[model samples]
Each structure stands twice: as C-alpha cells, then as structure tokens.
Target: MKLYIAEKPSLGRAIAAALPKPHRNCKTHIELGNGDVVSWCIGHILAQADPEDYDATLKKWRMESLPIVPEQWQLKPISRTRSQLTVLRKLVKQADEIIHAGDPDREGQLLVDEVIDYFNISKKKKSTIKRLLISDLNLPAVQRALKSLKPNSDFMPLSISALARSRADWLYGINLTRAYTLQGQKTGYNSVLSVGRVQTPLLGLVVRREQEIAKFNSKAFYQVQAHLSLQVNEAVSFTAKWQPSDNCQPYCDEEGRVLVRALAENVVKRIDNQPATVSKLESNEKQQAAPLPFNLSQLQISAAKQFSMNAKLVLDVCQTLYERHKLITYPRSDCRYLPKEQLKQARGIVNTLAKSSLPCNKPAQGANTSLVSKAWNDKKITAHHAIIPTEKSPENISLNTFEKNIYLMIVRQYLVQFYPAYIYQQTKISLLIAGGNFVSQAKIEKQQGWQVLFPKSKKTQAADEQEQTLPPLTKGQILHCQQGELLEKHTSPPQSFTDATLLAAMTGISRYVSDPAIKKVLKDTDGLGTDATRAGIIDLLFKRGFLQRHGKAITATEVGIALINALPEMATLPDMTAQWEATLTAISEKNASYLSFMQPLTKTVTEMVYSASQQSFAGLPKVAFKPKRGKGNFKKKTAKKPAKKSG
Candidate 1:
C-alpha cells in the first residue's frame, strides 16, 4: 500500500483530489479508490525536548546550570497533537511505501522527516520513503510532482541542516535566556529578558535607532532660491536653487545646507533680480522597466508602505490566498524571478486573470504580451519561484478586503511582466549667476506604459513637482530672476522605524555594516532571518514585550534597551549570527561537518555564561514585567514597610 503524508490537511486534500481514481472520502486519512492512503501533519507533531525535560532538577533557573547542552537529543510528541501522532503511527505501520509530501524548504523537510523517524523506531522494518517536491497545490502541479518522486535520502542534507539549526537555537536560546533572566533578578528586574540568535540583534537595531534619535540636536541652516522666467517663453518660468560660493565653505555642508545665516542672506541679496544666463542644457530619454514580482519580503514591505498593514498581517493574508483559495503560488518563497521556461505558463495565467473580476483593473483589462521581461530567468530561481497568482480564476470565490488587496498585488506584478517599459525624458539646465552655478531639473512622461495600472497618489505627485515639462531653449539665453528668498530649515533627525522601513532594513542590513568581509558574508547569506521567518521573529519580539508598536512606528522598550546593554556584542550583533547561518549553509551542502559548527557554538555559549556571571546590574533601571511562567514559582522580594516611630 502507498501512503502519502503532506505538510498540512489542505495540501492533503488537494493531493487526494489529483490522485488517479479519485478519493472516496478524506477524514483522518484519505482512502483513495486506488487503495492509496493520504494523510497530513497539521505542523510538527514532535519537538525537541526542553532543557527541563532532560533533567527535572533543571526546571529551576540557576547560574550554575548555565551552558545547558543536551548530549543525546530526544523528541517528544506534543501533548495537544498526540492523537494525530497516533493516527500517523497506525498508518505508517501498515504501509509498504511512504511519500513525504512537504513544502520544498528546510523546515518543511524536517517537519515530515521527524514524523517518519518517530514512527519507524518501533517497527521491525522501515518502509521505503520518497520525497514529493511541488511549488503549488494546483491539480496539475500536484499530479506532476507525484509522478517524479525522488528518494527521501536525496534530502537528508537539508533535514540535517534543519536539525542542526533547531538544536543550536535550543542550546543558545534556552541556556542564555535562563542566564540573563537570573542576572536580571539580581537587579530586582522581574522580567524574563528573553533572548535568541536573531531576536536580540533585531531588537538592537531598533534600540540603536531610538538612541540616535534621542541624542540628535537639530541644527538650523539656510538656502537661497532663484525664481526665474525664461526669455524665450513667458510660460516656461522655473525655480533654480542657488549654489554657495567656494570661499563660503563654512556655510555649505554635504547636504547642500548653508549653516551660516548671514552668508546665505548675503547670497540672496547678491542674486536678487540678477540676470542669469543658461550655460548648459542636457536632455536624455530614460526608460524604467516594470517592477519584479513579489517575494515574501517584498510583499510585506509593499503592503506596509501602501496600506499600513504590518508584516504579520501581510503574511497571514498571503498565506490564505496561497493555501485556502489556491489562487496563488507559495507565499514563503524568497525568489523574485520566474523560471525562463515559465514564460508560456505566465502568458496563460495573464489571459485567465484578465477575464476575472479581481480588484486590480490592469489584469482584467489585459497585458501587452509582445515583449518579455528580464525577470524570467532560470538562474535566479531559488527554492521556489516568485509569489504569483495561479491559473485559477477567482470569479466565484468570495474574498475579504485584505485578501483582495494582496491577491491584486500579486496579480498586478505578474501582469506587468508582459507590458512595455515606462518611458520619460529628463531635462537638466545649468544656470550661471554671480560667482556660482544654479541648476534646475525636470522629467516629462512620454508614455505611461505599465504604470497605468498603478497610479501615483497626490503626495507622490507633489514630491515630483520638480519634474515638470520644460519649453525648448538654447544655451547662453539670459533669463530674468524674479525674486530670491533665504529659507531657514533645521536638519531633521532619523525617523523612527516603521514596518515598511524595518523590513527593508532587515533584508538589506549589510549596507550598514562597516566590516567588508562580514558585510559580504551577510549579503551572501540571507539577512537576520529567511523571508519565511523574519515576520515571525519580529512578532516574537513584540510578544515578548521587547518592542512596542505606536501606530506604524516600532520602538524598543526600556527592558529591551537594557537587555541589549546587558548582553555581550557577540550575542547581539547580526554579523556574528549571519556567520552562523553561513556555516549552516555549508553543512547543508555537505562542505562542512556538524562538529565544526557545534564546537564554536559550545565555546560561544561558555563565554556567554562567563560573561553573564561577571555582569553587574547595579545601575540598571528596574523594569516592571513578569516572566512568562507560573506566577508562584519565582517571586520578587518586596521591601517591608518601615516601622512607625510614634508607636
């Protein structure tokens, strides 16, 4: 008997529907008409045992019990999901062959692999295990993947990498969190002070940004503007910014701000009503290609920017579209490009979506498929292709506003791939007045192209006010300066991070690092977390009370700031964690042994334990928070009230 095990029940149903002879019914396990059984795991049925599970005495937090590393790792079935485990064990015992139908990623590989290992331990003989890799849950995709099952041993490397990561996280998070929480107790701070490999560095980013903003002192500056009228055309008047003299270097900064008010006033007076001659004229036509399709991170960033939706909300919406409706491909992918061979499939998707009543009008109207985009390349494909709408039409499906918005975004990005590029003309004019040079720039849109589908808002239009149409003009033409004003402005501090900017920072953090080698390592490796887990990491920080969200902006709380200050740099810097990710990648590729990675991890934990022992929390501020444990287990000492003197 052939048994199929999927990652989730929804995927199991999809697979069962696609199998030959159809499925009679799907309940605990789908019994197909062809005598095959299909089942699924809700998620992980087994997890690595907690530290306390290793030894009952380790339940109480203690400094001496630091560096807790399990010698022989054990897996225990989750109490709430044990019934599913029982069902899976019963089916695995009767099966002659098993197909591992999980997501094509490291975590997915581990989720199903762990279950097989758990059930096969008691059996006298192991069933043949095979892997089914598919990008989407569509009927055709599922059938194709079923026909091309590979040996489960082919994915052992990825499963090993996932296992190593899980163990390492256990070693670092469980041990260090206990050590730090105990240290916080020394200062009367009654919080858990939770820490992780990625969570701490993410919090450090927010805390450092807040510190910089708090310490910033706004400085006043001034600039001169010339509102000039062209001699050739009366309707072609424009504003040109004044350039400071070379001798007035103190007034000019890198941002072109004139700090000295008196110098700026003198320049305004000197250039007032001055006759300016156009010394240089330059014009060039520029073309901008359509935006690439949505990766998980890019979708999160765009949703945050456009609709003020947070990262977690965006992921939830996309997941529904992918898993529930089956209207889109995988939502957890990191690649933003399609396979070159998928161009034909994309054309069919565009045609089917054009007839659907989706929220985005562009896909419904039609896409120009005469030209292909550079985004269709084979080498750019990673674990999965970009997030995109499937060939399925959503005409009869009911969708909420959030689902509609995200689905439209995916559809529009796909439709734009077939449209022509946006074309515009850039005009740059240089003016000579006094002893300095002034410049004016403008952009004229020649064709809306793919941008007709996504229109710019009023705020974006106002931001591009400088990009106005210019009349034809020749060089050396004298223009009349109508008026001049010295505008005073203060340098603004960096804005507090919003979900939009924070997501970008997490993905592109290598730009901020100073060390070249570490920066390259971080770039080559996925930043802080994978596209699939970054949102969860951010959510974890909020749930732990390490971060507070005010409107769209995120800030580190006092406890969070204190936690970073308390931990060593090696524990909080992203580069160090990124290096660990690089090592894990090497392990996955079989280029490095697991021992090489674990040895350094052991040394790092030992050093952190020593560091926690020597930390002095004398001046640390008391933060009001309770550790997430049983209330009566550990109590903060309360000072006794002073005795009355008049008694």
Candidate 2:
C-alpha cells in the first residue's frame, strides 16, 4: 500500500479529497479505494530530547554543566502524540511506498522527514518516499501536486537546514539560559532568565524602544500660521504655514521652528499685517495603484490596526478561513505577488465573490472586475503566492464576526486588484510674506476609482493632505492676511509598539541595523522568523512572562528587560539572526554543510558560557516574588538616637 503522511488532519483530508473515493477507517487515518492509506500529524510527532534524557546528572540546574553539547542528538515522540505515532509506525511497516504531503516550507519538510526517519528506525526497514509539495489545499492544486511528486531525497538540504536550526537553538538556548539563571541566583534573585535566539532580540527591541521613550526630553518649538483670503473669491479662505530662512540662526531652525520666545514674537509681529502674494501655484495629476495582496505579516498588521486584534488571533482566523471554510488560499505565505498563471483562476474567484454577499457591519458592496493590476507578476512570486480568496464563494456558510471580518479583508484585497487605480490632482501653493516663504498644499479627488471600494476609510483632500480648497489664483496675486499667530508645540517621543508597528518592525528589522553586509543579508532573507512561526514566537514570549500587552501596545516586563540587559551584546543584537539565516540559506543551496554551520555555533555557545560565568550581577534590580518583610520577622529595626555627639 502507498501511505501518505500530511502535516495535519485538515490537509490530509484535503489530499484525500483530491484522490479517488477515500474511506474513513479511523479518526487519524484514512484508506483510499486504490490501495493507499492517508495519515497526518498534529504538528511534530517527535521533538528533540531534553538534557535529562541523556544523563540524570544533567537534569539538575548546575553551573558545572553550563554548556551541554550532545555528542549525538536524540528524538522522542511527544506523549500526547504517541497514539498517532503508533498509527504511523504501523502504516510504515505495512506500506510498500510512502508519500510526504507536508506544507511547503523548511519546518514542514522537517515535520514529515522526522516522522519518517523515526518509523524507519523503529521498523528496521527503509520505505520508498516521495514528496508532495502542495501550496494550496484545494482539490485542483492538490491533484496537480500529486502528479509531480519529487523524490524525497531531493529535499535533504531543507531537512538539514531545519535540523541545524533546531540543534543550534538547543545548544545556545540551554547553555546560555543555565549560565544566566545561575548568575541571577547567585545574586539572591530566584527566577528563570529565559533566553532565546529570536525571542531575546525581539525583547531587546522593545526594551531599547522603551528606554528611548523614557529618556527622551521634549523641547518647545514655535510656528507661525496665517489665514489668507483670496481676492479672486472673497468667500474662499486658506491657511499657510511660515517657513523661516537659513540666516535665522539661534532664533529659528531649518524646520521653520522658532526656538526663542522673542524671535517668535518678532516674526509674528512682522508678518501679522504684511501683504502676501502668491509666489507659485502648481497642480499635477497623480495616480496610486491598489496595494498588493496580503502577506501574513501584512495581514496581521492590517487586522491589528483596523480591529485591535493581536497577531496570533489574526493568524488563527486566517487559518480557519483556509483550513475549515476553504474560503482563502494559503495564509502562511510571505510573498505578496501572485503568479501570472494564477490570473486565470483569479478571474473566476472575482466572479464568485461578485455573486456572494460579504457580511459587514453595514451593507455589503459588490466586487468590480474591470481591470487586473500588476500584482500578478510571475517573476516576483516566491514559494507561495499572496493570501486571496479561493475560486469558491462563502454564500451559505455561517461565520462568526471574527471570521467574517478576516474573510472580508482577504476578499477586499482581491477585489481591489480588479478596480481602477486611485486618481487625484495635487496642488502646491507658495506665498511670500515679510521676506519669508509660506507653503500650502491640497489634493482634489479627480476619480474615486479604488476609493469607492473602501468608502469608510476613503482618501479625501482633508483626510490626506489636511488642506481645503484654494480659490483660483495666479502668480503675483495679492491676498489679505487675516492674522498671524505663533503656535507653540512640543516634540513628542516615539509611540510604544502596537501589533501593527511591531509586525512592521519584525519584518523590516534590518532597516535599524548599521552594518551594511548584515542588513543586506537580512533584507534578502525574511526578517526574524518566517510567517508560519513569528506568531508562535510572539505567543511564546507572552507565555514566558517576557512581554505584556496594554490596550494594543506591547511592553517588555521588568524581568524581560532585565534578561535582555544581562545577556551579552551578541545575543541581544539582531545580527545573530541575520547571520544564522544566511548560513541556513547557504546550506539549503548546497553551498555550505550542516557541520560547517554547527561548528561555529557550538564554539560561540562555549564562549558565551565562559563569558557569562565571569560576568558579575551585583547591583542588578532584585524583584521579590513574595511580600517584603521588615528587618526581623516583620519587625522594623529601631533607629538609635544620636548620643550627644556635639563637642
């Protein structure tokens, strides 16, 4: 029998649906009429063995066992998943050939590969294996993928990269965590100082941003505003902001901010009654195309901004849309561009959505299919395309509010591709007053095009440019200045990280780095973590008590802040992730070996152990988990009166 193993039951069922009539034999396994069996894993059936599994002495936390590097790695099936493991082991023993139908990523490759290797080791027999790399779980895509299954050995490099990453994380995380936790314990602080390759740097980002916000000092600045009435239309009035010249040293800055009180007052007095003339008036037509489709990070950011949702919730909702309802394409994608070949299917999807009623708080709008934008370029597509609705409609399916909201987001992104580009006319007006240049700008909506689809958040002149209509005027035209006033404003510090901004920071972290090489590598690679794993990484941080959420903003906890500060600079910096990503990429490309990557990581782990052992933790903030007590058994020490010390 040909056995098929998938990443999860949903995908396994989808695969079976694509094959001939499949009979459900058990909840965890299925049988096809053509002598084939299908099975799945919830996630990872096996995990790397912990240190205690290797040696009983290693079970206890001790400084002597600081850097635990196993001579040979081991794996054990997770207790909760042992039943499924048993089913897979039995299937492997009876099958003549095996098919791996995991997701199309490194982690997915490793998931099925590990299961196969474990069963092979147990049954003492090697089965012929083939890989089914399916991007979409829909029947057509699955059928196409089945016809082009590649030899499982062809993906050994991906498996190697995944294994290298796992071992590296274990080696560094175990050793560094023990070293730092022991150091904190020596200082009378009893807490686990958890550290991770990706989590620590993410925590460092939050801590550093908080530090900057805390230390920032606000400075007062002054601006002069004038309300000018046009002579052409007496009823038409507009506002212009004053721009100071470069010669106004010590009194004003290049941004036209008057720093000195006297200087600001003088400028206000000089320009109050001065005659103003229109120096320049320029109007140009502009066009803005529809935004690209939703990548996982982009979708998370948008959902967070629009509905105050968290990253993990958004992923879960999108997963439901993909796995349960089959309403959208794959959600764990990072690419924002769709393949050109998919344009044919995209048209069908648009037609399907046009006939369905998309639920919203208000009335629903129909989808327009007049034009398809450049988002369908094949050259830009990566392993998977953007998240869009499948060529199926959700007409009769019942959905909760959360699911409806997310489904609408995906649907809108797809419908936008068929709408015309947003068009507008931009106007820039410059005025001369008291030998200083004042500028005003406005935008006129020439065509509502794409904005029609997004009426609630439509872009208008006031919303986008913050300028009202300016009456018809020509150069050298005079205008009446109603009044000039000094506006006192203070600079504001950076806002805390909301899910929207934090997701942006994670995907664009390389922008903050000063090193060109590392930045380039990070730019080429997806930032910090892949779309499939970033949410889990963030969820882990919250579970570990390293981060807390206020409203929609995330802040590092005291323990989290302290942990980042205690770790070495190398561990907290994002360059470590970038470097590892580069090495992992090379290994997958067959340019580097797993040993080559692991050797350096092992050396670094050893060095970190030694360095952390020498570092002292004196004077570090000590937070007690228990209530504070007075000197002796809840009694305070009496203050001794100074005894006649005057002499």
Candidate 3:
C-alpha cells in the first residue's frame, strides 16, 4: 500500500483526485482509493512542548527557574490543529509506503519528519517504505514523485537541523516569557513579555534606526539657478547653475540668488565658456535574459511593492495557489534561477500555459530552457526549484484582490523572461558656462524587451515625447542653455523603510559588517532570514508589541527601545544572521564542517541568553502589555530605577 501524507487537507484531496482509482473514505479519516491513505498537517500539527505542557507546577511564572532547559525535546499535537493530527496518526500506522507531500522547505521538512519521529515511524528502507517530495502538486508532478520515492534517510540531517532550531526557539520563548511575565507581575503589570530566537533581533533593528534618527545632527547647504533668454535661432545663453569656486557648497541661498542675478544682470558672468567635447560615443547591444524564478522573499517583495500585499498574506496566498489550486510550483524558495536540465521542461510548461485555461499570456521561446546563468545549477536546488506556475491551469479557484494581483505578478514575470530584452539608446549632453560645467542625459528604448507583458512599464518616456532624435552636436560645439530655472527646495530627510526597501536592506546587510570573512559569508547567504519567513519575522514583531505599526511605517515602542538599550550586545541583528547563514551555506556547499559552522552560533546565542539573564532585572517597568493612554495623548512612560549589575 502506498500512503501519501500531504501537508494539508486540500492537498491530500488534490492528490486523491490525481490518482487513477481515487476514492473518498471518511470512516475515521480520509483515505485515498488507490490503496493510499492520504492525511495532512494543517500547520505545525506537532511541536516542541512548552513548560506548561510538561507539568502544572511549571505553569506558574517563576524566576527561581531562571533557565528552564529541557534535556530532551518533547513533541505534542498543536491544540487547535488536533483534528489534522488524528488523520495523520491513523494513516501512518497502516500505510506500507508513506510519501511525505509537505511543501519542500526547511519548515515543511521539519513538520513532516517531526511527526514521523514522534510516531516512531521506522526509517524507510530501500525495499518497502518511501518518501515523496515535490514542489508542484499537479497530477503529473505528483505521479513523477510517486514513481521515484526517496528514502527518508536522505533528508535526515536537514530534519535534525530544523528540529534543533524549533526546539531552541520553544525553549527561549517559553522560558523567557515565563521569566519576564512573572517579573512583570511582581512589578505591578501583566503585559506579555515577548521574546524569541528571531523576534528580538528584529526589534533591535527598529530601535537602532530610531536612535540614529534621534541623535542625528542637522546640516545646511546651498544651490543657485540662473534665468536667461535666447533670441529665436540666436543660440541659448544662461548663467551656470554651479558656484564658481569649489570652496563653498553649490546651493543658492537668498544672498546667493541675488549674487547670481547681479552677475547675470551686469553681463560680467561671461567670464569663460569652454565647450565639452564627447570623448567617445559607443553603443553596444546587450541581452536582457530571463531570471531563474521567484523565491518566497523575492515574490513577497515584488507582491508587496506591486500590490501592497503584506508578506505573510502573500506567502499564504502562494501556498494556497500551490497546494489547493495546484497551479503554481513551490512558493518558498531561496533560488531565483533554474537549473539547465529544467530548461527543456520549463519551455514545455510555458507552452502548455499558453494553451491552458488560466488567464495568462503564452510565453514565447522556451521559457524553461531560457535560464542563462550559473545560478541555475541542479546541485544548488533543494526541496524545490523556484516559484513558478504549474502546467495545470485548474478552473475557477477564487482569490482575494491581493492574491489575484500577486498571482499575476508571478505569471507576468514568467512570461516576461521568454520575451526579448529591452533595447535602448542613452545620450549625454554637457555644456560649459562661465568656465564651469553641467550635464544632462536621457535614455530612449529601441524595444521594450521582456517588459512588454506589463503595459504600465512598457511605455517609454520617448513614446509620449518625440520619436525625433536630438539635434546632432559635435565635439567643441558650444551650446548655451536657453534658460535655467531654479525653484527653492528644502533638504529632504531620509525616507522611512518600505516593504521593497526593507527587503532589499535585509538581503544586503553584509555590506555594513566590518569583518571581511563575516561580510563575505553574509554575501554568500541571504541577508538575515529566508524569503519564506522574513515577512513573518516582521509580523511577529508587530504581534508581540515590540514594534508598533503606524500606517506603513513600523516603529519601536518605548518598551522595545528599553529592551535593546539593555541588551548586552547588538550582534544578533541582521548582520550577524547574515554571517551565520553564510556558514550554513558553506555546509550546504560541502566547503565547511557542520560542527565548525554551528559552534560560533552556539557560542554567540548562548552568550546572548546568559548576558540577558545575568543582568539585574531591577528598574524595568514591569511588562506593560497595555498601551497606557492619557486624555488626547499617550501617557508618559514611567521612569526606571537603577539596574543591578549581573552577578
């Protein structure tokens, strides 16, 4: 008997429908007719036990229990998700072959493996048992996976690492929450004291930025603009926008504007005019090749920017599209590129999409075979390739406005890759006035390239303007500006982080790190978190009250500020995470030992936890979960007492 264990009920249903002799048996749990019993996990059906789960005595928050460390991690079915657990437990005992049909990602791997280990499923041997892994839940994809069932042992290490992370987080979350909440109660407040493996670092990021803003010292600077005139066919003439000397900032204040006017009024500003010669005029054609595919992070960022969809929402939508609708490939991926072997099949998938019932433009050229970079290596691809649409275009699956937009974003990007590159011409013009120089430039596309799919982005500025080329000017051609206009402008403050910018910043934090090795490691790894969970991390911060959301901007609360300020060190932020991810990547690439890779992290986080506990708990305004309010204003934060030194 071949039993397929899906990640969710909808996926199990889809798998049953895909089978040849599919049947629905709902005696105790849903069983597939193909002699396969398919069951699933609604979410983390099982998880590391909390202290409350261990004993009632441990339930009460206490400080004497400083660090509640569990010698061996325990797993229990999640409370609300128990029904799914019942289904999963029943099928595991009876199935000869258990195919793991979870989403192919770290979290998914852990979810399935944890269940197997908890239920004491014997490791699948080569002859009798099997595990199925696939990114796409379509009929053909599932069939192919079924034909090639892998031994469960192949994914053992990944399962172990994932398990370790989950347990460690549970330990920190439960122990710390208890420790602080109890402390808060003693201090006269009952707010939840939130802490976690990834949440604290995220809170620190917001706090650090706030500090920089508060401590910033404002600076002033200047610019000048000249208003001039030219007779018809008489050549344009105007004062230079730049200051004559390099000693001062090039801005026009009230006095600077007057000086420019006096100089132009007197005609003495005709000090010097030197024509700027074009050193070289070169044009080269380049290809705008298709990208690999969308990973969770990249897709979420794109969706958020394009449709203003939140990260978690996007991930959930993509998951539905993949598992329920069976119309997209894996949604959680770190790779944006596809392997060469996938190229042929990718082309087939694109061609099929062209004819499929789904609303999409047929991608021309074999889109799959279109991967052109070293990034498309099969060796680097794991549980999934990248997020792409499946060949199967299932009918009328309803989606919300945001989900529809996100789905379109992925489909459109896929179609774009198969299209041609955007070809354009760039021109630069330089003028010399009063011996100073100024430059202007414009770019016009010859073709829209892959951008043609999205009409909004396809239109070039030149399309609305004139197709007529600029008047030809040779080297030594002295062309005067007919007019120069200057409008007074205030210096703009640094813009707050947006979804797109934040994702970009998160992925590129290694540049800010000082250590060369650390920087390089961070470079090789994604910034701090995986594309699958980065948004969730941010969301957790908001839920825990460490970060308060105001419109689109996220700011740290006073309590959040105090926590970071009290931290022993700042190494837990994105920079450090990037460095750790780098080492893990090395392990994946077989260039580093898992032990060496983990030792530093063990040392780092352990010290952070210790430092947190050793410090005096005095002075902290008990955990204040409620946002105190004053009439027409927020209440002031209570002053803190002096903290005792860590003993």
Candidate 4:
C-alpha cells in the first residue's frame, strides 16, 4: 500500500482529488481505489520538548540553572494533535512506500521529516521515501506536482536548517525568559519578563523611535521663491525656488536651508523685477513597469495602510483565501517573483477575473496577455512563487467583505503584469536671476498605462495638485521675475511607528543597522524574521504587555522601556538576527556546518545568561497580574432587589 502524508487536511484532500476515482473518505485517512491511502498532520503534530521535559530539576525556574542546555534534544507529540499522529504511525508501518507531502519551505520540510524520523523505520525503507511539494491547491497545479516527485533525501539540508533554527530559538528564548523572569521577581515585579530572539529587537526598534521623537528639537528655516513669467507672454507664469550659493553658507544650515531671515529677505529684494535667464533646461521620458505581485510582507504592509487592518488580521484573511476559498496560491511565500512557466496561465486567469463581479474586473478585461512583465523570471524564483489568483472562477463563490477586498487586490496586481508600463516626462529648468540660481521641475504624465488600474485616493489627488506643468522654453531664453516671496518653515519631528511603518521597518531592517557588513547581510536576507512568523512575533509583544496602541500609533510601555534599558545592547539590536540568517542560508546551501552554528550560539547564550545574572533589574516596573479564571473561580451572579419606589 502507498501512503501519502500531507502537511494538513486541506492539502490531503487536494492530493486525494487528483488520484484515481472511487475515493472513500474516512475520519483521518482517505483510501483510493488502487490500494493507496492519504493521511495528514494538523499543522505540526510534534513540538520541541521543553527544558523541564529533559530533566526534573529544570522544572523550576532558578538562578542556578541559568542556561538550561539540553544535551540531547527530544520531540513530544502535541496533545491536541496526538490522535492524528497515532493514525500516521500505524499507516507508516503498514505502507510499502511513503510520499512526504509538505509545504515547500524550511519549516514545512522539517514538519514531516521529523515525523518520519519518529517512526524509526528501517534504513532501506527510509531510502525509498519520496517528496511531494505543492504551493497551490488548484486542480491543475496539484496534478502537475504529482508527476514531478523527487527523493526526500535531497531536502535533508533544508530540514536541518529548520531544526537548527528551532533549537536555537528554543535555547535562546527559554533560557533568557527564565533568567529574566527570576530577575524581575527580585525587583518585586510579579510577572514573566519575556524575551525572544526576534521580539526583543522589534520592541527595541519602537522604544528607540519613541525616544528620538521626544528628544527632537524643531528648528525654523526660511526659503525664497521667485514668481517668474515668460518675457514674450507675461500671462504665463511659474514659481521657482532659490538655490543658495557657497557664499551664503554662513547664513544657511547644513541642509542649505536659510537660517537667517535676513538672508532670504536679501535674496527676495535682489531678484524681484529682475530679468531671469534660463541657464539650463532638460527633459527626459521614463517608463516604469508594474510592481511585482505580493509577497506576505508586502501584502501585510499594504493592508495595514489601506484598511487600517493589523498585520495578524491580514495574515488570517490571506490564509482563508488560500486554504478555504482556494482563490489564491500559497500565502506564506517570501518570494515576489513568479516562475516563468506560470506565464502560460495568464490568459486563463485573466479570463476568470473578467467573468467575476470584482471592482477590478473592468481592468482585468482590458489586460493585454501578449505583453509580459519582468515579474516572470525563472532565475528569481525561490522555494515558492509569488501570491497570485488561481484560474478558478469566483463568480459563484460566496466571499465576505475582507476576503473580496483582498482577492481583488491580488487580482489587480496580477493583471497589471500584462499592462503597458507607466510613461511620463520629467522636466527641469535652471535659471540665473541677479547672480542667484533658481530651479523649477515638473512631471507630466504622458500615458497613464498600468497606473490607470489603480484609482488615486484623496491624499494622492492632493499631492497631484502640487505637480507643475512647465511651458516649452529654450536655454538662454529671458524671463521676467514679477516678485519674490519669503516663506518660513519648521522642521518636524519623526512620526511615531504605525502598523504600516512598523511592518515596513521589519521588512527592510537593513536600513536601521549601523555596521556596514551586517547591513549588507540583512539586505540579502528576509529582514528580522520569516514572512510566516513576523506577524506572530509582533502579536506576541502585545500579549506580553510590552507594546500598546493609541489610535493607529504603536508605542512601548513603561515596562517595555525599562526592560530595554536593563538588557544588554546585543539583546536589543537587530544585528544578531542578520548574522544568524546569513549562517542559516549557508546551512541550507550545504556551505556551513550545523555544529559550527550551534556551538557558537550555545556559548553566546551561556555568556548572556551570566551577564544578565550580574545586572540588577531595579527600575523595572511592576506588572499587574491578572489571575487566570478556572471553574472553581467562577461566582454566580444574584438578582438585584427591586427598587421600584424611585418616582
């Protein structure tokens, strides 16, 4: 009997549907006509064993057991999924051959591989194991994957990389959390002071930004504008900003903003009613291709900005769209480029979109299938492709408001791949008036092209109002400066972190690092965390009372600030995540050894635990403890006595 073990039930059903007919669906396994059976795991049937599971002495959090290092790691079946795991164990023993079906990523590869390892089958049976990788649940995509099975041994490195990440996080998170929680107890703070490999650094980002905003000092600056007109046609006029020369450096700030009002006033007086000659003029036409399709991070940022939805909510919605509705491809992919072969399905997907009643249907109908964008490149493809709409028609499907909106967004982005590039002309003119230089620039939209698919919002329309349209002119042409105006402005402080900006910061964390070498590594990696885990990390911080939100702005609380101040600089910075990610990538590529990564990590953890022990968490604020309610804690409510005489 051939046994297929899938990552989840929905995927198991997808695989079952593609096999020979006469399917018999049981509670946990599906039986096909040809003596083939399919079973599944509920997410991950096994989890990493806790520190206490290794030894009874480690059960209690103590200062002596500062860094709890497990000599040999172990896996325990998660209680909730124990039944599903039991079914798989029995099936593995009975099967002649096993096909490992998991999501095509590092975590997914480890999820099933660990399960097979738990069975401890014969070496010969292990050698015969096959692997099935599926990124899309659509019928055609699933059928295509069925024909391209590969040996499971080929992905052992990926599984090892994931295992290293798991053990590293466990070693880092468990030991540090216990060490810090005990320290907080010393300060009379009666709560668990949690720290993570990724969450602490993320919280540090917020606290640092808040401090920067508080310390900012607004400064006043002045500018001079020349209202000029064509010499022949005085009716046609435009405003040009004055550019200060090197001689004016003493009166200007480092950014060249005029610090002294007198300097701006002098420029105004000198240029008023002067003959301004155009010293240089340049025009260039440019074309911009449509942006690539949504990766998980990009989609989360967009949803946060457009709908005021949090990162967790966006991920949940994407999962439903991918799994339940089967309307889109995998939602956890980090890659934004599609496989070149997927281009063949463009016409069918576009046609499906046109038949639907979506807001983007009209634009989808007009897509030119013959025009291919740069988004389709086989070289750029990673473990999985970009998140895109499936060819399945949604005309008869029932979708909620959030689902419909997210689906439309994905569809519109995919349709744009077939649209023409946005074309525009950029014009710049440099003028000399009374020994001072002035400049004017404008962007004229020559063709809306792909931009026509996205309607501008009110904020975008307001920005468009500032765009200027310069008249045709030649170099050395004379113009008259009707008058000069002096304007004063104040430099504003940096804005607080919002959901959108926070996600963007996490995605592009390289911008915040000071070390050049680490910054380059982070740029090449997937920022602070994987696309599948970033939302969960952010959500975890809020649950721990380290972060709070006021309206749309996110801020660190007093406890959060104190925690950051107490921790070591290495614990609160993003530099460590960069280094780990680089090494993890090498491990997957077989260029680095797992022992090399883990030994140093273990040494680092030991050092940090010792360092934390010596430091006093004196200023840490006391967290209010909320007792968990149990059956015995419940109190029945009594009916209030009638007070009817209140006339």
Task: Order candidates by lDDT, high to low.
Answer: 4, 1, 2, 3
The better-scoring model by lDDT among 1 and 3 is: 1
Choose 3 or 4, whichever is better by lDDT: 4
User: Tens digits of per-residue lDDT for model 2 on 498-584?
Assistant: 888878877887865657877776663447766777788887777666677888779987767777777777778777775776787
Native-vs-model 1 lDDT? Answer: 0.79
Q: List the residue pairs that clash in candidate 1.
A: none
- Candidate 2 achieves a global lDDT of 0.77
Ranking by TM-score: 4, 1, 2, 3
Question: Going through the candidates in order, what is the number of backbone clashes in each?
Answer: 0, 0, 11, 0
* Candidate 1 vs candidate 3, TM-score winner: 1
On TM-score, the stronger of 2 and 4 is 4
Output the number of the lDDT-best candidate: 4
In order, the Cα lDDT scores of the candidates are 0.79, 0.77, 0.60, 0.85
Please provide, for model 3 over 78-132, each residue's C-alpha lDDT reduced to its tens digit, 9 standing for 90 to 100: 7888876776676777677777777667677778777766778664522344567
- Overall local distance difference test of candidate 4: 0.85
Local lDDT at 458 for model 3: 39
State the displacement of the C-alpha of residue 629, model 2, in Å, after optimal TM-score superposition.
28
Clashing pairs in model 4, backbone N/Cα/C closer than 3 A: none
Tens-digit per-residue lDDT, 1-647, candidate 1: 88899998988888898886656774678998889899989888888887677898777777898778878888999898898889999988888788998887778888998999886544434435888877777887677678878887778887887787887787778777777768777887765666787788888889988999999999998878877887533543778887766767766788767788888788778877778889999999999999999999999999998899989999999889988898899898878988875676766677788776665544556687667898888877644688988878888999999999889888888888877899999999988877668888888889988898787989888877745566677898888776677889999999999999988988877865556788876663356667888899898777656788889889997767888888776677777677777777677677777888888988898888889888776545674553244232223432221111000
Q: Which stretches of candidate 2 lie above 4 Å from their native place? A: 22-24, 53-57, 93-97, 117-129, 148-161, 226-237, 248-258, 272-282, 360-370, 429-432, 457-466, 471-483, 514-521, 578-600, 619-647
Per-residue alpha-carbon lDDT of model 4 for 1-647, expressed as tens digits? 99999999999999999998799999899999898999999898998887667887777678798788888889999999999999999999999999999888888889999999999999999999999988889889899889989999998888998889888888888888777767777877766667788888899999999999999999999999999888744764788999999999998877888889898999999998899999999999999999999998898898888788888998999989888889999898888899878888889999888878877679988999999899989987646789999988888889998888788888888999989999999999999999999999999998899999889999899999977679899999999998899999998898999888998888888887767878876664457777888889888777656788899999998778988987888888888765786688678778888998899999998999998888788887654332234221223221111111000
What are the root-mean-square deviations of the candidates from the true structure over C-alphas? 6.1, 8.2, 6.5, 6.7
